[model samples]
Target: MPQMFRHRGFTGRIRRNYPMKKILKWTGIGVLAFAIVIIAALLIIPMFVDIQDYKPRLETMVSEKTGRDFAIGGDLELSLFPWAGISFSDLRLGNPPGYREKIFLSIESFDVRVKLLPLISKDIQVKRFVIEGPHLVLEKSSDGKGNWEEFGERREPEKKTATETQQEPRADMLPVKTLQVEECAIKNGTVAWIDDAAGTRNTLSELNLDLQNVSLDKPVDISLSANLDGRPLSMKGFLGPVGEKPGTGPLAFDLALSALDQLNLTVKGKVTDAATAPRFDAAFDLSPFSPRKLLDSFSVPFPVKTADPGVLNKIAAKGSITGSTEKISVNNGRLNMDDSAISFTVDAGEFQKPVLSFNMEVDSIDLDRYMPPPAEEAEAASKPKKKPDPEAGIDYGPLRKPVINGTVQIKNLTFSEARVSDLSIKISAKGGRYNIEPIELAAYEGTLKAGAILNVQKDTPSASAELNIMGMKINPLLQDVIDKDFLDGTLKAQMSIAFTGDEPNAIKKTLGGSGELLFEDGAVVGIDMAGMVRNVTASFGLSDKPGEKPRTDFSELIAPFTIKNGVVNTSGTTMKSPLLRLVVTGNANLVTETLDMRVEPKVVGTLKGQGDTKERSGLAVPILISGTFSEPKFKPDLKGIVTQGLKLPKTEDLKKALPGGDEIQKESLKDSAKDLLKGLPLKKK
Candidate 1:
């Protein structure tokens, strides 16, 4: 029993101290020593390497890749620790030989760091990349050649024999599958662009960029800040994973941009085939922006001034865009400018010479805010300036743009003192000719329908319009359009007018058209024809008293007029009242705003009838109205009144009223008969 126990203990001890355990322990010690030695070598090797000796090779490699001369003016640095990295200082690359600029790109310092663990797996994982103080110059020569274009000679691959081509295995040129950058930063960058042909030079400075988690498998956050033409700009965005095939992958993104404190924009979307033929559905928001401030920040001048300084300040828009490289469409677009709100859709075709179609509706817009101030207008008018020739200062340049087809509808529109509601206009243009047809509006208690054609293809642009105004109040309509209230009534009118000029004054001077005006239960406000007749007769010692206060109230007034060379002529204008009738013949010069009219007034016998009477008891007077439309002079023709007042009595009245007139008349008649008979018979004898 004692011997068996001793043998079992011996076997157990042997089993405890096995050969595999000893081998594994020694192998671990060797691996530790080797790792230490390797680490020590990595730390010491850079000290003796003298990286400057490799400068020529590095420069040559860069030059070959870029097709330009490259140099490292300062030292090259290397570090070996948790990661390996190489850094360069004072590096410059020269432009193509013939370019006017000496250097294409220059960097004060550049650094790249790679994780050591990834190197074992043949995967390049950059820990950090930094570039400081880089300046790039881009130039375009007078001959339209750009400095960045490829200028180096290319070597074509030698053609392979058919047998060799079959023998070669198909393989990708670059086999690296995984690439990642954890962080990247660029600071104090500058870019300059020169266009010799255009004689323009532009520079951007103080540029900075920062990136985090830059990889193909996760979202990358990026931030950029720059100074563009003295304006500060900033952007922040996140881009979705780029995937294995970077350009063709679907991407989701969100970006925000701010410029000079004047504009702010945000865009969020998903894009497919991001880098080539990208198709995207995106939502964009731009708000709290000022167009005027943007222009001012860029040192650009504004062409017009508004009455309210804030009128163009608060512009905002929200919309969705769907597009590819060749086409883009904006849908559900909502815009707000000051007090106006507009919704629209725009489809643009043919990206080069874009054909645009738009449909828009505005809730309300007060155009008066965008017009010149009244004080400025009055001051301009008060200045002593030469009368301008209207035809000399007109420009038709805006008509030469690409075609535009659109429809615009406005619920309410206000201009100066005029208010219009429910206004709609259809517009189309092609080849310098534009048509604004089916323009309908509700204004001044009536409806106005008009269409206009403007042909700017000629040296002098020609405009034609046809208008129909129905059941309009003449007083307010005239006051709004022409600042005159010459008549008051409900009016129905139609006009077809045309003019050949681009300037307002020239068009007025060249106006030619014909129209008819019909006013019912209206009155001429400025002067009374009946009052003038009565006053003239009473003054000439022929009538009782002047008629009532200087207004001619008529039950109906009708005038059919023709316009020629800016002059409006009416041959027969008739006005009928309860107690009087008037006929007016006149010519009004629209350009000069002058009136030359003759008014003949007659008193009617019956108060409630529409027939002419030959009663001679009432006075007849002819009045002359001449002067400007604003201030006209009404005068009676005294010679005509006196001639009319000295008329003889009728033949019957004279014969009946005379004393012994019957006997004298019989004797005179007998003598006249005898004389006539004797003359006829005596000629025969």
Candidate 2:
């Protein structure tokens, strides 16, 4: 028994102690079962594994479907596990005839969900989506072809059931609710619609748009805040399909945008069809907005200074418009600038419509503040020759006193006040030139109308005007035409005065016209013709009125006169006095500031034939009225008569010099001695 135990010991002991054979067999079976279960789970559960180069496959698919080249240039990645999401960095899409771009799309992350339960129920559902850094360039030629519509030939009509047509189709291959974004930005994006048939194109900018709560059946809400052509625009709005409407695609929500310190408002009207243009209703409230302020904010024609912030803040307006994408109409509006307020009722056609109608009124304004600035020659000379700055002259732009409140009717018009009357006025300028049409001015009670043209050039000043007086009151009308003094009688005449010059003095120098002067007892201030000729008689001389002082030699003078330039002539008039025929000629020198006149009279009646010796023994007066207009010098003709009077002897001494008389020397000596003694001062004793 001992020998037998020793030989069989090794095998039996191994089997009993360790159980090696059974352990090895069970271990192999367990490993094989685990491998089988894992392989089955991978295949049957539809496990998705992400591939880094996945974008190529998508590009290939899109290229085939659309018959156009599609490419993702840079990195392409795919996510696995929870949801299958694909991302393509730097992607580019191409339509051969229309568009191409560079540095396309970069999708940082995304997800995809497969619905097992829905799949079993034959329902299609998407569970995931993602987006990051995508940029697109959409362009079209001026002829009207575009990349979006480039594949028109390759597209086929979609076939669907009546029920599907009536209702929005459930999202297939896309999630019902999608939230996608992470520092998602788009650079240099563009959308252009070109109609080759019409040869028209409209291009809109492309920038980052934050999309949120995107659903197939609900409104599409988006927020856009970006710069367009250097102008910042911040807008938020929503647009979506209406409730089961056949033709209506979507209705737009109110859109609010803020810029230039002013809120610009917009609203979408009812949507009709895809074939129709997008219609909108909008309102621009300029009442709270100033054009000057807006210009300042944008830095366009940028402000030169801001010493007084309110200097450029005068205008305010309120208006509303409604129309299609291409045209708009304004209903009612009003504007206020400075002291003037204008109200308008307008009926405008399309934006492109050429004909428009408007009625406006000017409530009142201060003319002095808005008058054109005084011209400066030095300021004009300092400007550059090629593109010289404008003259620092009067600025009528603000219309400080624009009394334009009246019904203004215009079809296709050019109007001015000078043309309304016989007096013509012209308005012109270097940068601005316009000839006004005949317009009826309703500011005053009468049916007043006038037209004019003004030419205010930087280098030259010119003007012309024509004023017509209609049926108006004769008295007040004259005041506006002529000066305060001249003729007090009522005037009813058609008078026209024309001027051609820049300055007031120049204009007056060039004035020329002729008109009748009708009068009812018009009086000449200094003379009374009837009283002078009739009352003056030789017998008992002239009789004075009761309690009146005797008439002086100058007081009984009478004359008639006519004026031309600054000279006065009295050649064609009758006057009665101690003197006879009288003729006066004078020239007034305004430049030298002097007035000179010469008077010559022929003695008449008792003094007429006194001695036909032709010896001068009468008044030869030279009147001088010289000085500035404000303070003129007036006195008798002293130089002409007083100096000559001192040269005349008291009497002729022919008798004393006669040979038959007592010694002339003796007589003369005696008289002279007596006169000398009388003229000399007496001694105190």
Candidate 3:
């Protein structure tokens, strides 16, 4: 019994010690085996697993996928410390057939380091990815085919063999649990675009892009810089976590762009989908700069040269835009140029051919300053050259585009010497035609309303307008429009005019219209109809006092006129006053600016407002007004006066002219003597 107890105690101790010894021995063996394998791999694996030997396979795979030839001129390199990295040098991608450029893409080198342990969990964790000296060319042929689109062609799938199909179904590749990129950089890159159809070649050089901490679940910060067409541009922003599909993520960006002139712009925006059809809300600020200088910097010619140099300078704008692929909206848009301010809003649809609806307001604008000086224009026009046809240079191509509907209001607008206030215009365009309806404005102490239609569908562009003017002061209007105040009155006028031409002279020459004018309590300055008539009748000749400025005051003047082929004809333009009544019948040639008019003046019985004058009746005088607009001449109608004089007989010769003249005269004398005696006696029966 004692011996059995001792053996049991020894067996219990042996059990505890044997368990610890077995664990220690196995642990040592595992350590030794792991070390040996690692050492063997580090020393021997590279010799057998040559990456260059796989270059042909890699090239073949890329060629099959892209339908283009791909080649690696330099060897492939691999590294194993810290992380597994693969690097390639001098890679070239060939362009498709019919392209002039052989190579579409070429890279000096590309390096990528990946965390090897993440593969066990089916996670793609990249420590760093770098690209250096990459040159990419994009070209579009004359037939509108682009080289970039060649790779997108669909290819038929390879059918599985019967043996492969009979094999057991392979286990599923594990889903990616995590995808992280510590850093990615592209440096010294160049992109060039060649468009044979447009005859344009543009290049972007010195392109550098960097991304830090790019991951599937965290925001990635990005910085980009490039020289575009010799202009430096920079961008920096953050993008939110990427989703399963491209462009399905939150994005924020800021960009700064500047040109050689004082042109600078800053843009800030947030995009919901950045890769595909992005929806973005963006705000932009443009610094005050000269448009002329900016255009010159881009080697673009400016069509207009303002008379005042400062007119086109100091242009700036601030606005916000929101849009998707199909539609866009602009809000709170403001443009400032010199002393003018304009605010507008626009909603547009159909990005390819936009149809726009807009509303805009302008505080004030002086368009005269932006126009060429009159003297300069005149000088240019006087040069010896063949005149171009009126319709030769009219380009109606823009009218074929999408339609626009809008309204524009201006508080004050000045063009040349004409000033308009409280102007509002409703405009619409469609089918190669534009209409400006309900154009209302206040001008010359009066209200004017008009509508105009321009049709570009016709071979020769044509325009028609209808205008109404009410209660306008004629003196100020004439002073501004013609630089002369020929009359003063409250005037009302209405007209409908149509012309078919593309040049100013042609339009005036082709004008055809009719209108009526009425003036109340006005005076016609620079000429006196009554005095001219009296002088011409008395002397039967033209007579004028030297240095005398005569004016005719009238209670009312009414003129109804018609125009045909640039000639204005008035049948009977009448002017009524206390002293005289005058009628004018004439035609004025607008093209030649010449007047051929006849004026007839009739004297009334007595002048109520003037000093007592003998009653003058049965006296009519005809005068002729014939001259250019700048220099007019007034003269008596000598031929008509001579004819009237010859038709009338003298009073002393009336007995011979009429048979009963002598007898009537004797009877009249006897009756007059009897009446005189009766009046002296003061007797009546």
Candidate 4:
């Protein structure tokens, strides 16, 4: 039996392996038959199938799921193998009409894989893709009844896996498990980020992203780069669920990103709990942050003055913040900007904190180069009409810069400065409002203490402070203030001002605070009160003392005056010759720069009983001033007499009798003075 079976080649010795020719011929036939079936399916089946209906069916399914009207124009074609994909050419989609909704999405060329099986089997695969060249458009109406995000509440995620049917995951499908994605790439991608809430639209160009080896059981690695607003930024990161758990899985990540020429940032973060409530901690390091450059990148204009151009080049910052569901804390924070440094630590427990502190220090700043121009000067310069002249008109106020350097003490803060440009301040406050204490500063010396309440909500501030002067010189400050029109006196007064205001003009108007103004041995500049009094007396027929020569110097004109609470009171001092005694008291409203005063003049130290001999013993002058500041109406009238009451020398008679009238009148005028004084005993000598 075995020999018979072997002769038929059904057993034993394999019958010397069938003839190679016959074996190969059958294999070729079988392969040819398989190829024929495949070609028929590829070339003929798609032609017969109604692919147009698939478009509406897809549209209906989308509409049903999203509760939005969906429509598509044109037929869809699905190819079978070898170029295996779905194609939609000249396709247009929109939100259905007649529903106050407007949405339109169009595609010129699109193709997608018909099956995802190959991708799951570790092969390069894609499902449904689109390629549009410059003509694709998406539109949304202002009313917001449009596409993707406008869909109603999202469906709940499923918690199970799909069965062997190998269908697309439905809304009710199980939570994703063991998701795996192989290499994916994009080229020349462009996307627009639109924020309807903020009404902002930003476009990113030349965008590229590469994602590799993403897995739910493993870490995900990604790299992306894009050109944003003419700046290049690149980012790389790795992310994963922590501890290899699902509901309990946390997030762990490390990322590095930077904008070209502006800033570089690196961060590491982790979330410890994904269920109940999440707890997270993150540390960030930012380096080479240029304030000017960063602001410029965002199109913000900065008016900073730099000694060396582009000196504000770099800044570095490091900080870490940790927070649970209810509490948060920060530690190890430091910020460095050029030569400046700031550091702080803060911790909070559900908004309840007892101690918080901050400290800052600045190396140096130039005040004169950085401070803004005076308000009056800036305003005058901006006017197009006939602008007011700074010096010709009255400028009630002009700003003065003070030299500022030293440590500042805040509640829990201490800010130290090496030197500040163009700033001088004398500030003090009482009763929670700045009320200048009576003080005079010869020169602003060292550390100053500030008192003020800064109300950020109202965007208003009130401050008062006392600048402590250890030992300083005053000549320079006094000279500068005098030159700047703060006062019109050669007198040097050492004083400090305590004032509060949001503006320079306001502070100037209130430049008054009760501070002692000490005058050294300097004389009054351009003020000759004695000469004025002499003229008044001469015009009034008031006689000079017999032994004394006429007075010329103005040092004797003004008696010392003290200012307090807006009142000026002359000291009780008597002048020597002509025996004039001045008694003046009045209030000077500094805001208006007006003086309302009463001047009483009396004779003293006369040879004879001048007071009794003269018809008037005292001259009470009522002074009135009116007009714009620079040129004012300054008139002083004797209480009982007018200007006509004064006696005048006979100038016409002397002029007619003199050849050298201009010169002889001067000598004859003296002889006439001798004649006019003939009756006095001193004149006889």
- Alpha carbon lDDT at 632, candidate 3: 50
**Which lDDT values do the candidates have, in the order given?**
0.78, 0.43, 0.77, 0.48
RMSD (Å) per prediction: 14.6, 22.8, 13.8, 15.4
Q: For residues 1-685, write the lDDT of model 3, one tens digit per residue.
A: 8899999999999998998999999999999999778767855776678889889999999998898999999989887644778899999999999887889999999999997656777688898899999999999999999999959468799898999877844322225667888879999999999998888887899999999878767677878888877877666766655644435566666666664447688888778856656799999999899887767776777878777866786799999999988899999999998999999999999755569899999999988888997778878877776778644686777675768899999999988678999999999988779999989999888989999999898767888899898988888876776566568788888888888887767776989999888898898775555554443322221232347555678889999899888888999899997778988899988778777988777777677557767664444556676666655544445465577672332444323223244555444323321221222211211
Candidate 4 has an lDDT of: 0.48
Off by over 4 Å in 4: 1-54, 61-179, 184-188, 193-201, 246-250, 274-276, 289-316, 323-341, 344-359, 366-377, 380-443, 453-585, 590-593, 597-685
Better of 3 and 4 by lDDT: 3
Question: Each model's TM-score?
Answer: 0.69, 0.40, 0.70, 0.50
State in Å the error of residue 163, model 3: 24
Which ranges in model 2 have alpha carbons more than 4 Å from their true place? 1-74, 78-86, 90-208, 212-218, 226-233, 240-250, 260-274, 283-287, 290-317, 325-327, 336-340, 345-353, 365-438, 442-447, 451-466, 470-685
Tens digit per residue, CA lDDT, model 1, 1-685: 7888899999888898897799899999999999999888888989878888989998999988888989999989887866899998999999987778999999999999998766877687898899999999999999999998885766799999999998775332233457789779999999999999988887889999999878778888989999887788899999887666666768889999998878799999989886657799999999768788788877777667778666887799999999888778999999998788999999887666567789999999989889887788878877886777755765666565658799999999988668899999999987788999999999888889999999988778898999898888877866775566457788888889999976556887889999888888887764544443443333122223235434568888888888988899999888887667878898988788777988777776554444545442345556666766655544455555567773433445334223344665444333321221122111210
Candidate with top lDDT is 1
Worst lDDT 10-window in candidate 2 = 411-420
In model 1, the Cα lDDT at residue 305 comes to 73
